[model samples]
Target: MTFTYTVSPKDWLGIAPIVVLVVMALVLMLVDLVLPHAGERSKHTGPANFTVLPAVGLLGVLGAMAAAVTLFFVDHPTSVFNNMLGADAGTLYADLIILAAGGLGILLSPAYLKRLKLVHQGEYYALLLLSMTGMLLMAGALSFLIVFVGLEMFSLALYILCSFIDKRQTSQESGMKYFLLSSFASAFLLYGIALIYAATGHTSFVDVQKFVVAQAHGHAPILLLVGLGLLTVGFAFKVSAVPFQAWTPDVYQGAPAPVTAFMSIGTKVAALLAFMRVFGFALSSVQSSWMPVVWAIAVLTVILGNLMALGQSNVKRLLAYSSIAHGGYLLIGVVVSGAAQQNHIGASAVLFYLTCYLFMNIGAFGVVSLLERIDNTGSDLSDLRGLWYRRPLLAGLLAFFLLSLAGFPPMAGFAAKYYLFYAALVGGHPELLIIGVVASVLGIYYYLRFIATMFMEGREGSHASSTHAAFERIPATPRPTRAPTGSLTRAASSTRGATAVAEKPASTKIAASPLPATAEIEPTHELEGWSWVALGIAALGTLVTGVILPFWLPQLQQAAQSLLK
Candidate 1:
């Protein structure tokens, strides 16, 4: 009694990553609240906080990432804390992806926060770290308590992040909408967990799986089955599966681009991890009951997500729908993982796809964020009319990312898609493979259309009139004026009426003297230093992932195999 300790250093080491992140978040917030601002500019974008907080936040992410990698090789059981949280290789893999997204988001944040004159730099980075921490907890959750705690923790942080731009009404709407919908989903998940515990007398995943295995197929209690169904709803909502994806486009479009750049990928990684655990392993014995439901949702999401993305003029909204479609692709792996004898292959595909997606998706969103910072014009198609002529490097980058997203050959996206679809065929789900391929083909149209818009120039005569008209919206001043978020959707409709009202003679007069290429638009090659670095790294990741497919596949396969145990 005198010498023994209840909580030892080894126990803390079990959750070393979470501890590092939580401590970092607390330190940043305390520094922000305690530090004094001596000047007007410092009050909003404090020199101290802005410069140091993001760097600190990035450091925290890297530290946690390193800790996760360490946990992978440590000579300890994967499950720690009485099997409440798992430091399994699968969870560690998901944590790395979440942290990668957060690091990139931090890199993209400085300019966005400064440009918007947002205060609370400490809270911003702190919340981001906390969110990443929660995602890690959720991914590694071994008990229902940890799952709900992790879910609520991340959800609360995201609500604040979503409405961080309080000056914009749309941000408020996005936050409120997400809060309502997500809470409802969480309730379903919690209720389901309770039912399962009541039916099986176990709240831990391993115990629950043991109970399920003991019960003969189709003989499981009704309450346990219902609980499983409810869990699916919660996970489905998180992944933005169809019929539950209404919040995605608006939230992605309304949230600060930096936040979207991270949330779009990180959230999926966490949700899918929990989903695979609960469905692919814990409840696999009863897979015959749930596979049909998941299969249907996956097909619907793939078809509808691409179809909805086809007409989106807003790049963020387009990417949001694109995200929903990718979710469907990820789900295919989940469904196939339930297919007997193909568990490892299907699960591994999901991990590899997520690794590829983290780079390509964030890079695409970063370019959009850059355009927003530069011109306050990324929210519309008109902003992209002659992007290639205006910013060749940026246009080229966007083109490469879009092609990767489109699954063009030799890009990571193609390799990712290839593995996920191939898993379906290996799992005896040829129908899912067929449906996914067809939907991917449909998605290529919109992606290529975006690339074409960016790479191809418009007619010279039209540039003087139409392009000049579009240019009028961009301010020449150093600090551009702010407008309500999502105003473009409304303005686009009004522009149709105004287009008819404009005099033909004024347009003809402008077209007579077409602007020369030299003076078309000032070059904006000089982006913020950190943003350029983030984009450069993302570009390298996008290309290198595809190029080094052979190298990483074994690691992912090894990670995926851990989930089955």
Candidate 2:
């Protein structure tokens, strides 16, 4: 007997998102090379003089997003290179979220880099495109080999992006730590793939699924279970869950804010989407084995991520822990999808929550980045004190994003969490719902602390501003001259005298000042046009999408139905 193999155009079309991203990445690289010193010279000057690299990179990311949306309408999932990549609506949506996050990262980078005085403008934008491309590929890959390839691509780009600030030891330390741990995790993941291939003589997810189902009662089942466990550990590290999450806070603190913002969402989406696809479609027959494991992981991750975040005075660490907590919440959707046997409603919940997560998480980080001093440090919560008094619009947006993250009612985060729990309940997982609710309650403390600080606290002492090395080091712009020591001491003494008697009463009556009237606001010399615009866009997009999710859920459900098919 003879066997025939066939491939079709749909297979080629399936890879369009990756193709779009790669092509745009090349375009950004070429632009970087071709742009004359005219743009480079402006780097030393004010924000108005900065180049259009940010805009160009964003256009590329948007183009990729558009292509991904178009791919959703193509109505077929296709596997290419002998089933190495699987492109479907799920992959398309995941790539869209990654691309959108990358675009925002590009927008935020210039201001961040400008502040740090580290200007390799071209390469920063290029690396973001490249990293986004890897994430897109990872989202679509159907075979273990392809998944590994895509994972490394994304990881490598991120390694470089993390260490982009050559001047900062913190950035270098973060890059090295991520690279070492990630390499170790990838080895386990690849070993698991090798073991699976050995048992079934196939690395494609579809083939692996068939093989597992066929040998459900045999020794192959044991081997497959071991491999799956190893795979789970690998992804756990990437998404920073529980014990595997030790690296997240350090990495977030060390890397530039924009890079951290981008990595937090983009990496999690890619990794978790693959986690769901692997277990949901491939190893689902043995769901009983992994379900309990993921269940335990979910509960622990939620509780630990939130509980640990409660004492955080460092803003980046707080967000990092929050990201881990949200990872657990997203995992609830993952588990629901895994356990559900009927419609793809559970998978839809994962998609909706991830989509909402990208916006809200990135928006909050973008606000933190905006408040950071130029050298990409200074992520302390104290920096955000009185933010409402200085920039009420930005502060209000940040508050909204935080509340959404805490899963408060009526916001998109609430809707996403509601669907996630509802999907779990529909699938008969009440324990998961209880854990989620409890975790959410634990999340309240740290989130509210920042909110309270912004509204209630006075601005930090003027002495605090001088501690920012990035700000003090900006050579072209002169710093405000300080008063002589004798005068300063007298002023301090006078203020202390005035406050001593009133301190208790003053604290109770202080209302958060509305944003200073625009005309009355002090002129901040170092504000970069592109950076501020990026922050604005991120904040605005988050609010708009979060508000419209109720309207979008129907279409999202339609997309979800396709995944179940």
Candidate 3:
């Protein structure tokens, strides 16, 4: 009936990433109020043109990363706030990834927010920082109480972000669904934690491990198994595993594109890290008991997630299913690491895969953002038709990202999957390996469909223009569409300049105004430089990081080993 607790300086070091993030978030939130607009930036100014919120956020995340590097030298694991959280290398690494995701989310947000005419940029960035802080806490929490707190903190921020576009009923529905389902999952997780505590007389992983070791003489306790199963289901929902993944497709499709991108990569990574921590470290002794259950879940996740994804018409929903399938792939690594006791390899592969997943997911969604600009609707597959002619660079990036998701060669996703499959092989799990391979093969269809719809196929007449009541209420009638033009040589070049102008009234059509030919040529030179830069960074990261795997893998391997220790 008693919980013994200890606090130490080492515990602070374990949560160093979070502490730095909190400080940064506060600073950014405050500074955003006074920051000047982007148009106000002068090239010869005394300060850089970076907005206050993004600048502070990036620096804070970098600081968190630096602290994580420092955490590597600290040896002992310590719990603080009466065993609320534990600080160790494993958690520090997870925090590092969480921080990186936050930084990227900030970078991708502003331009999109501006395009959509969303207000309260400061509040948005502040909430993002807070969410990152919560993820850092989730990665490090040692006890169930801390875990619940961390999960709520992250979940609340995300729910609000999802519904930020208040005018869109789909966005509101997405947030409400996530809020209700997530609350239900959290309650189960908490109840499971309580049950485990009742059976073992402890909530901390260390104490639970000791208690379980003490109870080794008896048959496996039913309460303990039930509790563990409940907890696993809770995590399965968070990571979008099969059966529990019902919310994913709707939520991803309805939410804003950037938020979907953030959730796809960031939320899954943090939850998986927590999942790995509990299953690989806390419950390692119960491997024989939980292994079969998780293995079945993994198989189902792979089969169902990929197979169902093939039928989706919406791009976001398709990627949602794709993420679930990828979760199954990562679960294979988790199973290998836990069952075979090669925790380091599994952990390393998970981290590497998560990093790779982020880049490609962001690239894919960035292309979605481009298409969404034209239609302002969800990213249906038809929206991507003729994308190659409209935006060649974005189309190519989307294809590359899709190929990566399909685990094609020379891409980071391929390398990440290879490491995972290798881990499964080394761990002697042939069944999981087979499931992974088969699922990946099935995944190729949807991924290729995306590419083909965007590039290879003819420009099909998609949705007719819908009425925009806020603007002129044009009747919902189909426009006379033209055949696909292979090149943008003549008519496209003439209309290119007017297309870049945002917020023009729908009634305004590009008529051939009597202008000098030389004047018509000038606007073509004024490119949308910022969008190109964003695309370039995303594409470059995807290509550069995977190509240098040899250099990065050693460092990741070292970090992974630290968690095992």
Candidate 4:
């Protein structure tokens, strides 16, 4: 017997974003090969360096965004490729979020790579776009097979990107750790999918939902329950909830800052949306079985994430913990969405909160990226002391982002939290509201501490002394010297007015210049034009979302409705 499959033009349209990204990534690789290296040509030449790669990648991302926007407005929710994927408002929204984050990450990368002398721009942009494609695939996946493929696709790219900073041993360690742990999680997820298929004879979400509904009001099979438990564990690891969160801080601190910023927002958006789809819709009939477990995890994540962040002196590690806490907040929306009564409200809240989070989180990390040194040093709290006195604009922007993350008034974070707590109450889970409130209160202390360190604290002499002490510890290279000076040398020195000019090698000229005091260190001097553009976009996004939130609520509601359908 022979089998045949046919694809429609509309199917092509449904996947336009992925197609564009993949093609552009290939084109970029080819372009990189043809372009001359920086040493081979003059700096003024357009292709002399990798500068054009980022611009091309950014254009690709914008094209994908346009396609996603068109699909979203067309409002045609359809299952394509034999139900392997689905296109709807929720998927489109997730795609847009991922693309925006990817674009900002690309914008933030050119300066960071150049400053650190990690100039593999072609590979960097290609991997970024490819990983984004995988994220979009995961968001739209309708079957376990597609989910596994998308998960592995992005995970592999991220593992490489994590270790891209070849000079840092910590970067290599981070890649190894993520590879090992994430592979273990993927195995568990796959096994769970196998068990689910064995028990229900289905892999598609729609089929699973049907089977679950039919089994409602009866005792669920032990195999099915076990599969669900394993699936939950796998996803919990991906989201960095509590005990599974051990890898987050180390990886975030070691990886390049642009990579961290991208992963922090993009991975969460994709994984959380998948979690909602699988648990909130597919397995929602068995809510009574899983609700308590997820509830405990959510509470623990919020408390532990906030508590751990309080003692962190490294900005990257602190933000990693902050990401974990935000995951807990997102879980509240997930829990409420699973409730049969007010699912739309909870679902809409999740989408809106993610939208708000993308701006503030990226903005915060952009500042950290600027402050980082080429050798992977800096980013310590002491490095930020008296920041306002040095760079007022960056200091003020960081303050704004920190305030938003702490859920201050007139920010999108506050609006998002209000919607989430409201959904919890309406869904009859008032306890979630109480826990979220307390967690947010505890979170304020750490966020404010960072701001206070930058503005209220005075520059201490210890920092300068420590820096100078470190500088003095370096062993100076010995240079060849002439024999003891004779009367002729003395006569020549006298002829030169007793002052001899030393002729040093060209390479040492820059190093021999007077070093600034540690208290006056200005890391932002390394920032390039593209980095500032990214910062501006992130700040504008933060302000716009907060100011126009009321006008955006109804659209969020519609997106939520489409997602549930």
Best by lDDT: 1
Q: How close is every model to the real structure, measured as TM-score? A: 0.87, 0.85, 0.83, 0.88
Give me candidate 2's TM-score against the actual structure. 0.85
Error of 3 at 91 (Å): 2.2
For every model shown, the clashing-pair count is: 0, 1, 0, 0
Residues 319-345, candidate 4, lDDT per residue (tens digit)? 999999999999888888888434477
Q: Model 1, 246-322: lDDT tens per residue? A: 99999998888899999998789989888888888778888888889999999999999999999988788989999
The lDDT, on a scale of 0 to 1, for candidate 3 is 0.71
lDDT at residue 535 of model 3 (Cα atoms): 59
Local accuracy of candidate 3 as per-residue lDDT tens digits, 1-565: 7866566677677677888888888887767655555554232111222355556777888898898888777675655666667666666666766776676666666556544545566667778888887777777777777777888898999999888766567878999999999999998888888888878888887777777767844344888888888898888898888779999988887777767777787788777877876777677777788888888888999999999998988888888899899888888877876766644678878877887887877778767765554224536776566678766877888898889788887877888887788778877887777778888998999999989988876444322222122222221221323424532233345532332211322333332322222222222112234334555666777776677774677667665776733
Question: How far off is residue 130 in model 1, in Å?
Answer: 0.6
| Reference-based TM-score, model 3 | 0.83
- The parts of candidate 1 lying over 4 Å away from their true place are 1-6, 34-36, 39-41, 216-218, 341-343, 373-376, 459-527, 551-559
> How much is 492 displaced in model 4, in angstroms?
26
